[model samples]
Target chain A: MNPIRWLVGRFPTLALARRNLSRATLRSALAVTAVVIGVVAIGAIGMGGEAFKQDQLEAYEGFGGTATVEPASYIEEGNLTNTELSDGDVDRIRQAAGSATVLSVHEPTDALVQTQSGTLLFRAQINGLANPGEFYETRNGTIPDNWRQTVVIGSRIADQNDLEPGDRLRVNVSDEFDRNFEIAAVLRPQGFSAPLGADRTVFVPTSQFESGGYEQVIVRVDTRTGSIDGASQAIEQEFNAREQVVRVEQVQEQREQFTEFFSTVNQFLIGVGAISLLVAAVTIANTMLMSAIERESEIGVLRAYGYPKRAVVSLLVAESTILGVVGAVVGAPIAVGIGMAVNQLLLGDPLAFTAVGIQYVGLGVAFGVVTALVAGLYPAWKAANKRPVEALD
Target chain B: MAPAPGDDGVTADVTGGTVPTDEIIRGTDVVKEYETGGQTVRALKGVDFGIAPADFVAVVGPSGSGKSTLLNLLGLLDVATSGDVRLRGEDVSTFTDREQTRKRKETIGFVFQSFYLIPTLTALENVEMPRMLDRTPTQTRERATQLLERVGLGDRLDHYPDELSGGQKQRVAIARSLINDPDILLADEPTGNLDRDTGDRILELFDELRTDENVAVVTVTHDDYVAEAADRVVTLIDGRVRETEDRRANFEEGPDT
Candidate 1:
């Protein structure tokens, strides 16, 4: 025999419930539709939120091993002094960060750029790294190994000024020194949280800075060979062993903040979804109450024939549960399909569904069943507690 | 211990004789009351009744005579306010709710005037319902089939209640009542909705069940033909047993016997 048939034969209450629900096809269908809507709302929203969060987290993928070490401001002789990191500090950071590349970045300076639009004066962030090729990708031109007397502009600056590689431009640094140099390259636009604020910045050789102290030390660790946490801890210990001298900010911390933010958003969305399920629960309660009222005499007949109160309750609850199961079974796959579409829309990968997303579907289905069961409880109890004599009369 | 007929404190003996030892069910001094609209109304006032095995008893009474109330009490569907209702020599009040349900399922079957067949279930499934409560479907399937065939519903076993006529529905109910092989079948106005021909056929089926299946049949009805067909008729008036007419002696000596 088929498994469902065997199950129905084994549990006659289930069989009766199935038959009873089928008796009012339209009512049962409407009830099931309500549950389906609830399940779809919960599951699809949960899954879509998860996919969005994952996509956001993926944007921070390559920056996980990056950390920025900046000198913390200290009071010196009754005056607040924001000191620059010395060469010794850079050496210590490099030593502490095992198998990591350390680069010193100069403080931003107000500069006048000769663009086709005009001579625009803006605060331009400057990097004084020896090798820019290791940290940045160029969109228009390449950075030479022996890069000297040349400047690399960020994509934002290039786009704003219509500047290109090999273009000759004069930049006045801090209104003190000026030089005309060929633009070596236009760097690609890094995302919002990129170290050194790569966008809206310019790259120059360390020889151009003339200062011995560095404004910021950028450390990039190869996660395969070294741990970012270990590097951050070592850097912090080396600089602030006795007092607060340098502040270490790991990319992981920002990622953690983003994750927390997304988690909160996911919960809120799921809560919104649960409200729909609550409405579905009320619908189920109303449907079950109506069915109990309609079947009062039949229930009395069952009671008179020796069905216990629990049996009557069980029969009614079974009907509701069947509605739940049917709705959830139908809704889960549709929600999954919706999730896939959301993933495709947001993440550009239809198969980017995470295990957590699938778990949300399961959670939605479980909630749907639980909601139906709870909704049916009162009606079942009321029906079961009815006096057979009163019902028959 | 059985209470003496008239000597019992509650009510005089309406059976006009001593309680039989082989009685399947007995009620002594049964009083049932209900609070309706802030006033207490006694549905059955200290009434004594009994049913022996294979007995065909009809309870005939006018409206407000507590015929259905007595049937409800006898079927274990309701409890008496003050009385001793015994089944198979055991006091019914001593049984817990679950035990009462078990006893009712195993020993007594109930039929209703409305037939009360589950509209969703087929004739065979309806017959199998009581046995299904015992959770032995494989064992009772053949019995349900046999009972439906015996009730002349063999061809209509798969037909739902809505598809069956009044007489056919009543026959299905009669078959369902016998599915558990109950010693007593309590029916409240079993033929109240049927025509004269259908009612007569149902009464005949009751007679055949009592004689051939050895099941006692107790029906509460206002139909005189039903009262005439019974081996005994108990008349109730204003919540009290008015008379008990014994026709079993005449029935056994009749031409059919």
Candidate 2:
């Protein structure tokens, strides 16, 4: 039917629905509140999950899958102890991980260093790197090509010690191997770069720790040419064939695991929310049945006036639908409020309002209205089937 | 005026009495039974009755005389146990529930003792309800307005039923009964709640409807005033027609008419 005709035909039905809802004020309001609670539970939980996923994706945006290869020593979880890597292993990884950049990371945790004049330098922690420029950009002077006795200090460490390039510092590498080194290049500030102290670290050539071996080999895969998975697999197989115990940490795989875990948690929360909506459906059905019973005489009068059974049933359904719609209208905004609260308190940033939330609101409304329609079916049928003569009496 | 031909070879005067050709309703041996508590109770027992267009009939009897049952059967609100009910020569007994509802909408209107006006609706809305159900043409509102005016409720168009007096509420109901221009008007104790003066005024309106609108009005009432004013009175007893008196004969040439 055309729009005008449809409106004309449904006008009376809507008017009657409004009147019926208004006439039984308390019952209708309570029914609306039940629906509101159901929609709120569903919409808020869904939106909260969406917002959290957005936040996590933003935090992990730029860090791509750079594989890290470390020795499989007996180290406990959450413990960052240094393990040995060989120069041979680094050379083999560069050849196996085709077109991938290989850098060796050295770690001698919390070694105290002092000035060349023997004046004590407070809080000077040192680390050694063979090619410090590859790991971090230089803030001032360039790295010396010879660099037989030079060191690079992190930006934070440079700012702390008033140290500059060409300055002399001494590190107690071992009890007898204590040596004085020149600061080669003061590097840029790097926070949590190598999963340990990168900011307060110093860089030295591989010659200084030739007998100590390497701690870990960092493999940078050019994702444009070869996949991270392929590079990681090649490196792992090379070590396995050499019978060298090692563990490869692929960033892409780790990220996927975290995403899967969050999705499962979200699904479980939404399932729990659905239970409240089920209870809401039962409440609407009971309320509609009672309303039908209370209006028997009015229905009889309508029948006697020659209203068809279909019309009677339609009128009752319309009333329940109106209740459902009103409840959804009231619940959606409140759910958004709760979602914002959850984001602020837990995720530390509220989700910026987006069209995505509207889809969730629409889903909530559809759920509420369908519940009401299904629940109201039996009562509407009963009202239609009542005998006019007996109902009038 | 000459007499119109009747099926029994008798004749009916057309000028001031029954018009034989305008037989609007006929019930042939209509029986109504009710099953209450596993026992059958007969409400109507093989009653043969008929009414003509523009006829004023009052069904009168004692408390359990089944007056309401007869009215319900005639209004097409309930089906007879076993018999034929013809409306304008069409057999209504075999009509489906939907067909019955359509037939009632097109031919019958009802007024009850309680007025039965929807409480939420205004006087105008209550009057327009039946026509709206039938999806009558756009002239429905105009006709309902004229009807309310004719029933002396012109100024009370927007008043809800709860705001109206018993007499006014019944007047609104009377206006509602005429909205669809049905041939038959069935009123069951329409003035049962009104005072004597108000009841008389309502009867006067019915009298006017009989002559002005040419409707077949069948009212089930116990009021003697209604019986005295009716063109004919059908007295029922024990679910049967005990007596039928034509009061018109007593005032066949009365000046007040």
Candidate 3:
């Protein structure tokens, strides 16, 4: 109890440490900023990778429908770009199936969009019509009635033009002389549905899209609702006599890729954060070592005055921990906020950062503090061990 | 410069100077050495010494004359390479670091030459440090106040070391050493850095402290005037014991062992 009281009473004495820091405040602040910049850099990398993976996941899950399959042939090629699957293809596959319900779908489009501000003149898959409302259902907005020069524009184009609900945009699909489009309505932002800011999305009605052209057929089979592969195989054998324009999929790999991509990205960023923290640890160690050197005489006096060696060590370690904790308090929140802001700017949408977890922030502080404490240990102990009679000289 | 055999050299040959042989501390065959710049320097070479209860003794020596080394060894701040340093007749050489610290805390008080009060602490806090470390809170406040009052800085308790004069800082140092109430108070060149007037006042405080507390006082000083203030003076030369001057010559040495 008395020792505690004494330490508290002498807390003012320990605060002389601040005067010690003020002599070289700029250098100390620079050291703290080094850790801050590292954290910010880590947050930035985490944000960019989040954007890329989200885009890829949306592209993958676009294959979601009532009964989905990806055949070995269509395993890699999503939404074949240069072929056609007609009602004849559905009829032949149905005739081939006995006692099985079958729907062979192939959505095609040759529509273009022109925007007032800017546009992405890339190809968009005309997703199959078994789930026609999937686009309007998965994403919120009005769907086009048919393929016309008029098109529903993506929000990216709207944002670029500074346009809103009643505004119309013009966009060209491929080259400047290709088909131009006038936007009748703009779509809402749904994750990464439209390729980021700048839109040339033309979602035409299925019939209008089929009237233009398409690449592959999706063969859906309902063998008692659970045996999709049976009808799929019979259709495949029938198509074996023809060119392999159709494919089957397990329907879950699309979602699996999303989980895997995010998990992989999360693991990679955490690894980088850990490595950066390790470097910060070294920085803390160096700082404490230099500070100890500067305060050796002060330490000697404290020891000479009957301060137990244990007390001296604890004082030094506690001082360093306070430094690290103060630095972290200044850094982590700024990083989280900066991450959110940059994501909102570049992705034109809010980006949530799971890069710095609460546990990780705690770990970062521990890393920094432990580093400084360890570095200060030997020096503090040496100070305590100095012979008072010798050191007074 | 070697003293007569069997005579511990710190006692001065003057009126009322010789100390009683049986005392709280005894140093036998004490030797201290240091390696300075790759050369072995012997500081205290087999210096025999003794201090009796309530004796005010001053160890006087020139620079490089081992006075400080002997002080350090006596204060338990450093170890003598080959010596038997006893506390109350028990050899303290083999004690653990904790044991040594406990001994020092309980039995030793130190006043440094430079007035090594903790700079951040006020005069009161500086006096209060050891008592706090030793966990003697109840007596700490009253004793510190009384000692400060004795040193004539009772009103300046809250003033920091830098705010005080050199003598004031030494007085605070003196107050701190007494706060422990040790068997012996050791002052290492306590007045070295003070002006003559401040030095005289500090020595006067030591005298008053001696008269009031009956505590054994050992002061190591380079100044002849400082040594003259003590009842006994011990001289050291080239790491060896020299003359032990009894400042006030005694009729007989007490009960020679």
Candidate 4:
């Protein structure tokens, strides 16, 4: 027979299962709670992981593009060094990464800034960029077109010194370079990323620090041409071929590392959740077995009424399935809510509902149902095998 | 089982005239035994009986006299240890378990002492269960409704078993039993839990069903009123039939005896 017709024939068993579950409200509720807890664990962890990954990827994207290339000696061990790269090196990187944009950065040095009164103020990193517009924008005035004695400070430095665009401050830029520079603009806040301290750094024209040379070059891989990893590899080879030591930090690779880390953590949490569901399965099995035993006479009556053994088994399975389905129905949304709550707490935003998160919810529901069905098999079989006369007794 | 003395041997005239007089159910030398702990106890030993269409027979016996065992075997709810139990002249022993279940569904009905109504379903749902296995919804519902009306429970169709009295629940069960219009109705101590008035009403209903529905009614009862109301009475003592009396003949001979 066709599947629809077969299922229609089993409607009575389904109805009977639902009715029996309703009859024992507390036991059914407990079984459903087990499924709820399991689904919640799976869904929250899955969705929360997605929100975290998206947050991290977006933060990395703040640096612009998929990968960044810098001289290998720019950082020594765990500290920034006074290493430099020529403009020719940046040009070669752009050539090797065909159709890519390479923005050159000069020395990133820390200097003590003094207010107009010469009162000692905060010491912050100073950055000189050939193309500063690629990384940041002004909150007030625009960056200076000329490369003389003007510096654009980040919001943190401006707020710390009560300085804004047009304000003048004397910087202790080494003994020979100490001078008063006009603040051309105050930059908008940028969250954490590469280059160590970009957010708090002051930006000056790259020409002002030509003697200092370029320390790093941010690579914007042309995804329209090919894979970012391939472009990064080619760029790194070009530098190595020139006998130049360089480090190519692919943002995509870092995002992948974040994804891999989240997946491992998610898997561990889902495993714990699965264990709870397993316990629930045992609970459901015990409940179904007891129900079958308690309803022995009722089963005998059904058997005497000419219901087949298969029908009896179907009835028991239907009971467990209903428990699972109902629990999932109640649990899925709560899991999403929990994910949102965690996202809001950790990332300052609600959970971003990703396609993968939806699939996890579906998996959770399927897991709950399969757990109950598998757990109920032995009990259903036992019930189906009982003799009518023996059951009636 | 002294050769079931009869002139026809195959047919019996029980109901007025419309019923076919052919024997619909027959059991020859039926024996049933059970192994309890380490000992075997025989529940039925060499019992012989036959029922025809529209026949109302009451099997009256003491507890442990195998009245229920005999009913179970005849209704195809249990297998006999030895001898043959036949439905429409075909031995049930030869049929597979599934076939026997099909036979039970198609040809036999049962009324249990406890009503056996699924408490979760309404009276109508309980009644409609028998035909719901294979019949269309409209046909099953109509038949169930008519049966409930016949049992004087048409208005109680939506009520659950817990909402009904014992007699009302039993009436629903009786309606459920007839949903498929079976040829034989096996009732085991059907009125065992009812009051005298309720029991009398149920017995009268059974009597009316015998003539009107033309179904053979076999009731295992301890109530003397049921035995008196039946057309035939078979008494059993210690797993053996002691007497089979034609109650109709005894009634016609007048109450003097």
Candidate 5:
């Protein structure tokens, strides 16, 4: 049997409802349009939020396998005690880090640099590692295998001063320590989660910082075989086990905090979308109520013909449900299109829809159907309960 | 007055004594009241009415004479306020709403003055409606087609009520009422909306239903032609039965007599 014929045979009220809705084509179209707008609002907002969160999450990628161990300030007697990490502390961190490369960083210093615009002064972070090749990548030149007097400039400072690899720059730490060094390379811009704000720093050999203990230690875990969390925990235990000596901050923790914050923001945006659906529900209620009132005499004829009240209610509800289903089904793909556009605009990948984004589309469809059902209830009940004689009159 | 025995062996004692076995519907001292703006108004005051198989009864009265109220009680569309309305020897008041709906669907059919054909549905679908209520549309499809053909609407079966003429709509309604094969067909002013020629055709169709289909038809009308064509006419005046006339005898005796 044909499915429509079979369905009509089984649920004759549905056939009646379909025909009744078709009788008022413009009104029905308007009601269905309301539902479509509601579904699109919810699904599109939810998908857009998901795409934004994913984009932010991608920025935190590649930084997870690194941790920065810095000296923690403590109160001793009546004074604040801020101490630097010593060579002994670096040795202990290397021991606990287990296959992780440890590079001690010097305290950042204020230096005057020679620029095309003349000598300018700014605070520059300095790192003096034996093998900087393991921790940094160069955009224009390579890191030398041997330690040298040559220095590498960070991308931000290099761009500001028109300096790159092979450029000769004069640095004045003080009147007593002024020297000219060749710029070996311009380092790549490590994103916002970079440990020591590496984008604006300069890197030199350890001979430049030969006077004091290290300011911080950077542990680059072998992400392919080692865990950053394990390395961070081990280094913290080694340095701060007996006293508040070092603070271990893992880049993975920052990523997790970013994810949590975006999740809350996505929920808030979805809540805002649900309000539009509530307004659509009110429009559906008004439409159904008006339909019921206009069909009073027709309903009376059905009741007098012995249609049960439940059947009358079913006919009206079926009409609203059809509107909801058509609206939701049509809205789902449009929402997906909107989601793809958002992803393409924000993340540069059109198909970067997350599972949660698709789930939100499904949620919008379900909410649309439920909203229409709830709105139709009172009208169906009121119409069904009218006495046949009164309705006929 | 008591109804005389028909050829089908059905009789009704409308004088309120013993219940007849073959009466399709009977209303005994049926009273109906309504509350309008804090005032109680009696619509029907103790009217006794009954119909047997193959009977054509016309209820005629002025406006507000309770003819429609009596028709409503007899059709099981409304319950009598203080009297008994019975269908096939069972009191309708004793039935639950579901049972009443089932009994009404199975035992009675209704035709309204406005024709009341669902404007959205075609003539055939309107005819199939009563069976559709029973979830038996497939089973009723052939029968519904035959009914439309019988009512001279086979070519117009696909036409909606709006596309149909007033007489055509009434014909579709008549076919719809017969879909359930009910014993009683209650029509409230079935010809009220038609012209004289169309009204006469509808009256002829009612006569054919009474004689050929053995269906009892009770029409409430103010039209004199409808009352004159019925086997019996019950006239109501001021919520009470003023008189009951047997017109079958006059038809049998010829017009000159």
Candidate 6:
């Protein structure tokens, strides 16, 4: 068949798709716009969930390979054993593991650092002080083991006391003991990394930590598989067999809580996204139905020309699918931008690049297409089945 | 013109002698009934008919005479209760509406008193509709334009149906009917809505279509003058034939028979 002739034979019926939409252009545009809105909502929510998952992974990366070993004391004084892991212990783990970087840590007992501004307590929360080889996370000043009368402050502590390095500090070790001390290393903000070691901490020497001394070691293990786990398990076994008052735990419950909270938020966002899509679908259906009613006679002419009912059905479907695809294509990039903007305002960070994969975008396009078809089906069927005699009369 | 005493003049023994027995349309023992509001009313009673291919005939009757019921049956628009209707030799009683419509498109064309030209279409498009329905676009378009040219609406082809006068609309209608080159033209009072001059022109057009194409033409008219224009006239009253007359029904059988 001469395709143009066949198309012309269809007359206004062929033209009906465009004219049908044009007649109620506002309604049709609104319908497609609804699909766009739905796509944006769904894409943002889906992308946000994936971002949260990444943040959880970043939290794990901050730990590197350190095993925070706990002391063997509890319940009574609400304090675990600070059975200081001496320099020998650090050397032994380094020698035994060979593939690990080990650092021993301790927290001082009673001490108050009084400056020219005011007095702030340098109360160490046990096994948190380092002996000045260089802590991976010092907010300001290094902990000095060479000069025993010096200490380092954490980011939280520095921010809290409005203090900086090169400051003179008065340290009263207890009510009975006092000395003048210098400020050592100040630590940077470690974000969620400090849930393992110390988020709000001050570091001092092993000599300064008199009674309940250091028991833990932060082992930065360069492991591929379960080497951190293996190392921690090995240390626990060694202590258990030797009747030592110490054990190692692979602390991660805090990270798990963070993940669970984010996942719940993600599920809630998805629910809202789905509801928006459903509303968009209804708008599409309504648009098509109105168009069908407008072009009744045009469809009648096609029927009279022996164009067959299915062709009329196909024509309507094709037009709707085009509408859907156009809306989705246009909506996607706009939605991504808006998603980023929303993240910046609500999540308090200019959002990082989150790729809504091509497949996800393709699925969004497919969703738009399917929603349109679903919207167009009944209208197309009614158009196809209309009696030519009735329409002509 | 009076027959000898007791010689009824209608349906004289000429049926076996002069009239050809082979007919293009035959309706036998036909009865059509319609039920309305719990009442069964018979529209036709055991009707019988035969039409020849060359005849230009008009079936004339007053209102409520079952003339329409018989015409509908003959046109294959309605079904008979318990009878056979043959169109061009096949039993049309078994045909579905779609098949009947197809047969009508190929074999029969209709003209209505109301001049039912689709108001939205131009004269050219209206003329083209049936052909578009029946044939390829090239053929249908060529035939439609040719028919319009034939009917003298060649200049006004692009004018909408509403733009045409009654006579011009009828001319376009006539062109449309012949688009598929149908074998029979069924006109129900083709000139009923026109004035004398326009009606005469329409009748003249019908005569041209019939005489030139050799198409069998059946028209239904109430005008005695219109009846006289046909080659033969069949009068109906109370759902029964009252008179069957040729234009020269007064003549006796000559040697030409």
Residue-by-residue lDDT tens digits, candidate 4, B88-142:
8788888887888888888889998888898888999899876656637667778
Question: lDDT tens string, model 3, B114-230?
Answer: 766766567987888775544455567788998899888989999988899888888898888888777788988888878999888887776666556656778888778887777
| Clash pairs, model 4 backbone | none
lDDT of 4 by residue, A1-393 (tens): 556544544575676688899999999999999989988878877777677666666666765456777777756688876466777777788888887767777654555667788877655677667656666677988876664668887877788878898888776655336778888888776544444345577776666663646777777765666667777889878877676588888876766676788789878877887888888898899999999899988888888888888878888999998998888888898988887787786567774567987777788888988888888888888987898888877
Instruction: Give DockQ: model 4.
Output: 0.34
Task: Give the runs in model 4 whose Cα sits over 4 Å from its true position.
Answer: A1-12, A64-247, A339-352, B1-21, B246-257
DockQ of candidate 3 (2 decimals)? 0.26
User: Total clashes, candidate 3?
Assistant: 30
* lDDT (Cα atoms) of all candidates against the true structure: 0.82, 0.75, 0.60, 0.77, 0.81, 0.64
Report the error of model 2 at residue B173, Å.
Answer: 1.4
Cα displacement (Å) at residue A226, model 2: 7.6
Which residue ranges in model 3 land beyond 4 Å of their true spot?
A1-71, A74-134, A137-142, A157-178, A193-253, A274-276, A329-378, A385-390, B1-22, B133-139, B247-257
Q: Give the TM-score of candidate 1.
A: 0.78
Model 1 Cα lDDT, one tens digit per residue, A140-217: 898988888898888888887778998866766673457777889998776545676677777877777666778888
Model 6 regions more than 4 Å off = A1-220, A223-229, A232-356, A382-393, B1-82, B86-88, B91-141, B147-257
Q: In angstroms, how far off is A148's CA in candidate 2? A: 23
Candidate that would win on DockQ:
5
How well is each residue in A67-169 modelled by candidate 5, as lDDT tens digits? Answer: 8898997878988677688888889999999999888877545556665445563656666666667777889888777867788878888887778788887
The 10 consecutive residues of candidate 2 chain A with the worst lDDT sum are A189-198
lDDT-wise, the better of 3 and 5 is 5
> For each prediction, how big is the interface RMSD?
1.3, 2.6, 4.1, 2.9, 1.4, 5.7
Q: List the residue pairs that clash in candidate 1.
A: none
Evaluate every candidate with DockQ and list the scores. Answer: 0.52, 0.29, 0.26, 0.34, 0.55, 0.10
Q: Against the true structure, whose TM-score is highest? A: 5
Worst ten-residue run, lDDT, model 3 chain A?
A193-202
Order the candidates by DockQ, highest first — what do you get?
A: 5, 1, 4, 2, 3, 6
DockQ of 2: 0.29
Fnat for each model: 0.67, 0.37, 0.22, 0.55, 0.73, 0.06
User: Residue-wise lDDT of candidate 5 within B1-257, one digit each (tens)?
Assistant: 22323434544354436556877777676778989999988888776666778788888889998888777787787898987777888889998878888888888889888888888788998999877867666679889999899889999989989999989999999999999888888998988878999898888888777777778888999889888887788888878777678542111111111
Compute the interface RMSD for candidate 3.
Answer: 4.1
